[model samples]
Target: MSTAMSAAWPYPLLADMVLAVHFGVVLFVIGGLVLVFVGNRLATWPWVNALWFRMAHLVAIGVVAAQSWLGMVCPLTTLEAWLREQAGEASHDQSFVAYWLQRLMFFTAPEWVFAVAYTAFGLLVVLAWWRYPPRVARSRG
Candidate 1:
């Protein structure tokens, strides 16, 4: 939605926007790793190894793993739930931890499973960094 239109909309739309942004984050974390490995294999897709893109992808997953290990709720999830509540929508009946796993991937499991999965994926990202280093972008003066 346009910013002007969104501004005029009611509360529920904010919650929807938050959910969409959260899903985009999830896609980036997953797809970034896929491209890191696959893109390096092909002569194409060199942009995947742009230094800033690699760094952002790594940091993104790193934060996810850290949040899981620390048992902290993601701010996006918190904000979405609060917005939903304000809109008189049912946030969820599940516990805080459960909602974290459920909201993103649509699957439910022990939180430790997500912690381990994120940490393991993070290690893979680090390995990719080591094995296929990102190229620094050059600027034309």
Candidate 2:
């Protein structure tokens, strides 16, 4: 049975923990956009349009795009890799969650491809901001 893990990989637990946090961040960045559209059309999920939430989402993706264009790895990914190497190895096969999240988060792609995709996605987020601008709900007397 082959896996992303190598050697004894003693830090499988910590590595998986980092991987889970990374996956959650990925989901927030992607899902937040999806909800912005869905929430607006349905006139539900008012929190989606909150200024703070929108700004945070925008900043999150902006950083990702800037990092890609500048040829920088995500800090979270760097930390996770460091944790894996600390024990000389970590195994993705330690648990079902780890295995699947690892699969979902990683794929082989050229650097330029990622840079372009991130930039395009960042543009879409900007467009969303324009189309469905965020607002703070004020109290009604």
Candidate 3:
């Protein structure tokens, strides 16, 4: 194919990759808590109680909640939109994958609904932190 077509081809693929990453992050923030609680209960997956893991999980959800409350768009969403536009596609209405994922994660409700939902989820993450307190590594003499 022409150079122009070759150059343009990667944009849609890159956009899809970004969408996949965004989906993974959403899953981590939501599912991480389940792993933490259940793993702790089962006494399996000890790494779930690691301080760093717990803190990172908390921070991820906290950012989402804060962005919603501040009426700000997520950076990942912005990047995906820009990439889709570069690929000559509408940000949210283009590919089947994008359309379905957007429908699953996004809604046309008022801003406060998102803010409240995110805030509630964030609170749950915080509670998980307390419920399964992270373990501190001891120094060996």
Candidate 4:
């Protein structure tokens, strides 16, 4: 019976789930750009009320972008690919964004490309930060 259960769950689905979470976080960072431009709609969310959270999110994205730009591989992508390989699954192979990005995260990029991308992402991050300086609570006496 125990062997059956083990066989049923041979792969670590948890790692895949974590990869999904990483993807979601990436989406949020990109989407947050739209939110910044759209309006104060994000403020409506209770979570957004926390300045620290916003700052952290912004920083996290900035770091990811920086890593990408520096030609440094993303740990999450490497881990995901490794997990897939371990599970006897073929890694992604294609072009456009996914193929190349997956490759970039797995294999390092050229210095020039990394520099250019990093610079661009850094600019975007700066713009976003300026637009939405973390909200501060007012203290009433």
- For all candidates in order, the CA lDDT equals 0.83, 0.85, 0.85, 0.61
> Candidate 2's residue-wise lDDT over 45-88, tens digit each?
88899999999999999999999999999988887777767756
Native-vs-model 1 lDDT?
0.83
RMSD of each: 6.3, 4.7, 2.1, 5.7
The regions of model 4 sitting more than 4 angstroms off are: 1-12, 41-50, 92-111, 139-141
- 8-47 per-residue lDDT for model 4 (tens digits): 3544464465466666766677676566655455456544
Shift in Å, residue 128, candidate 2: 0.7
Please give, for residues 54-118, the per-residue lDDT of candidate 3 as tens digits: 98998999899999988899998899888877877766546788778777777798999989988
Count of backbone collisions within predicted model 2: 1
Q: List the residue pairs that clash in candidate 3.
A: none
* Runs in model 3 lying further than 4 Å from the true structure: 2-4, 91-96, 138-141
Model 4 deviation from native, Cα RMSD in Å: 5.7
Q: Against the hidden true structure, what lDDT does model 2 obtain? A: 0.85
Q: Of 3 and 4, which scores higher on TM-score?
A: 3
Q: Which regions of candidate 1 fall more than 4 Å away from where they truly are? A: 1-9, 92-104
Q: Please give, for residues 1-141, the per-residue lDDT of candidate 1 as tens digits.
A: 887546545656767777778888999999999998999999599999999999999999999999999999899989878876766666574345435744556557898998999999999999999999999988889
